[model samples]
Target: MGKLPAADWTRREGLRQLTAALGAENLRWVGGAVRDTLLALPVKDIDGATPLLPDAVMERCRQAGIRIVPTGLEHGTLTAVLPEGPVEITSLRRDVATDGRRATVAFATKWQEDASRRDFTINALYAHPETLEISDYFGGLEDLDARRVRFIGDPHERIREDHLRILRYYRFQSRFGADLDEAAEEACAALAHTLKGLSRERIAMELLNLLGLPDPSATIARMRERGVLQVILPEAQACHVEALKRLIAAESTSGIAPNAIRRLAALLPPAPEVADSVAARLRLSRTQRGQLNCAASRVAQDAQNPRALAYTEGMDGAIDRLLLQGAELSALDGWQVPEFPLRGGTIVGRGVIAGPQVAAIMRAVERCWVAEGFPGPDRIEALLEEQLVQVLRDPSA
Candidate 1:
């Protein structure tokens, strides 16, 4: 709501040195810092736009004895690691060519030209790092204050420049603003099919960010409504409006936010192969993949019986998985089940073989213990020994 206070003298000096070394003028702060200053959010990354070429910027940084990295030189980006933090410096550029996955850009001298190529107006604002004077070329400051996210030009054409904007729209909507614009929504729906052309890694990253939002189910439902989710995660397509509404209601009642794996697991229907394929396609990390698999497995097995929960998912595992499911079902008031008390060593000590027989006996003992209200170690050991003796009496019994 208020203009950002003037840049600190120290930062100004650094910028001045950078500009003097490069023989350039009008180096301005841009992107997230400018957007957040208006929103009063804590800014993390400081980005600047300048008319100097990438090579010239690097040369200037080097002359000043500053650490510089050509992170994306071809795309006109340079990273200068100042003592305060890393500042990203990018030359003004227009898209020379694009295939949605990558772009060829040519340097430009006008800030508006650079802003026009950006995805949204709210992000196109800039500020003089030294004086902290704000610049709104496309009414970005007004849009930022209004909390609206509008594409700089034609939505469909912008999306064609990079299909990732489709996901970025939802992310920004969830993070910074409220109320989706009908025209933006309609454009997203019409261009939904183009999302399939995006790289799997890019899609996965966007989906992960979306799911990490505080109230992701609504955004996900919007994606589904627009047929975008169908392209990236068709397995979850069956979870339409009603299912999402129920999930959101349940989440509101539970008062606990579900993590990405739990959220993704809840979105899936009762289909093993579909879950497996989705996990594989998304290239989920091993831990995420395992959690999703466990959640889906618990959901499929109808893990209602205490004995089954103890034997299959164990105590801690059962509690975690059940809590996630409870959040999805809005059944947080259910009674808590005790964990399994028996260990494999308890069965092995009873002269049970160390192979599948030991595992089988331990599982059975644990099941019994869970069903019997999780008896103490003494009782569990006695019950386990009794089962082991009976099993030893007949190998095939």
Candidate 2:
């Protein structure tokens, strides 16, 4: 792991002084900040651990004139909004009970006490707030350097403590570009069936985070291979796995654009009901829900059309759908759809009544104009007046 930069050292010193004011020992940085500092990845939120209780931390912050928010007071977490960003300061705590969803934890006075409750060994590393010294109670430094994702203790026990950890393991591994530890993978596989007990929202959040990875298709395929995908997203059980692999690999190799919706669309099964159900279960945003609907509809509509590329799916939507189609079929390069030159107002002004007939005339003119390669607005307007005159003269025609 690289040494903490000078600026990080400054922040660490500030936190240490805050801890000193609270009379708390062992106040240190923990979790992602430490892991990312080692990997040289950008660290956004810095999480700290301290023997001080949440109230005590708040008292210290108040003394320092720092803004404090009781973000997770019940969970022993306090947030101090610094100029750069909010720092999350959590009191050392160990889980007393868990139902795979929420945990009951008690504040502890020892750093190891808190470290023991963490999900993975790598996440258990801590850096002293003042000295910028790393303290690894669980061989976290070694596991991190080895690029191995391993649970702190018995995988089953850790998983049972929180089933979400099963999904988190894969998500973290994908993000860090680390290989899965064999024992951890086996343990995850063994408890894969228990994933059904987790809430759909929890599963959805993890999947979204997983998709946000640089190359999530392969990790997703691995999840499918382990049956974890089946348990969480049965709609995708029969997804074209090999096709997805090739699509992602090609995108990486051929410099093709990468997008999630396209990849998801490619993996969608043939069953509409299953697709809709999955979307609903995941509680997708209205826009995402609409995009999925459009992707599915377009895939079916353009199934046999060579000119499918000409169809109007929104640009973002098209990219998503095409990626999902995999590399086997090429997506038609998108082109802007022609706008209608005449409106109902224009048609009514041509002595046509302001009724359904006006709308009908506008539609007819627009369709013909688009079909005729969308000539200039002047030509389209002249053609529309002529067509309207002919239509009014011959009702039957």
Candidate 3:
């Protein structure tokens, strides 16, 4: 990590345009972009640190015929909107103060001061735009090489500055570390109660992002043992960890990608009401809540017939059930569950005296069709005819 990876990311037109706007000597790549570059991972986000003030940044970008937004002018951050994507360039800043949720900051010209204000050492690495020289402020290079995700100064102080960092620490560790930082883990556990002050959205975001990582089975088990998981999700128990691990193994075996909310459901007791309560507490989106409910209430029919399950519970829910149950998912790959071939109008056209009876007949036929392995539309018509005759013969039945 002496220099940034020998990649074309630096040669990107947007970055070149940005470098030309802010003198190459004045701009340095910062944050995750710099960190991931050192690790040779694909850099998706491009952020930079500059000694120039926000007004200067805006004027420079404008004079260069570049589009820049005053995204966080108060914090001296401006986003250079480029063709590749928006790159955030922030004036060197030192935190004025923080109260675990928000921070007040003032601009400064020192890079070390800005790096000191960041959460973790690995994230504070900086890279020169032209020379690709990494400015190691907090031994980030060493930490990066060691696969460590340690807090910058004091882990406790960092967590106190933003209680969300407690979760963030674990999230970063899960993503980047090979082993746990015991002292940092203890700090997070000690101050886990402070997480209550943070917004549910923030908690949900971090928790889900952690759960959605490549495979967070070990990290999750660590969180559970450290008491951090219980602080955030009281519903989770020892068994849920095992369930999540099983789900991970199943996901790998079936070649299905991981879904964060689905993993959250695995942590929860398999009950719809419990899932509902957790979703409500976390202020999850309607789609997320629905998935949680569907997962909690597992379908009795096994994944042996995935189409029927997919038909009733939807593709997302069906895949969730299959993964949780550790069932084969080859049937779901590139398989778009088709709509029920029968329709209410089709039943009504058969002279069955349309009403609730039409819907009833349609559902009965649909169930038979599903039971018979989601046969073709032609088969559904025959099933519909037989059901219509049987219902018409015995209206009470």
RMSD of every candidate to native, in Å, equals 4.1, 3.4, 1.8
Instruction: Judge candidate 2 against the unseen true structure and give its global Cα lDDT, from 0 to 1.
Output: 0.73
Model 3, poorest ten-residue lDDT window? 299-308
- Where does model 2 exceed 4 Å of error? 1-26, 249-258, 270-272, 300-311, 326-341, 368-375, 382-390, 393-397
Residue pairs in clash, model 1: none
lDDT of each: 0.73, 0.73, 0.87
TM-score ranking of the models: 3, 2, 1
lDDT of 2 by residue, 304-383 (tens): 43223343454565544555554323434444544555777777777777887777777777667755666897889778
Error of 3 at 26 (Å): 2.1
Stronger candidate by lDDT (2 vs 3): 3
* Residues 105-204, model 3: lDDT tens digits: 8888888888999999999988888889889888988888899889998999999999999988888998899866788988998998998898999999
List the lowest-lDDT window of 10 residues for candidate 1: 324-333
lDDT of residue 83 for candidate 1: 61
Model 1 Cα lDDT, one tens digit per residue, 1-397: 2356543432546666665665545587788887876776777788889988887787777878988988988788888876667778999999999998788999999988999999988898877655567777787777776777888878888888999999998888778766567767788888888888888878888888877777767778778878888888887765433454565556566565646666676677645566677889988888777777776675634445534464456544454456545523222235454556567776677666678988878767766776676678789878877786789798765
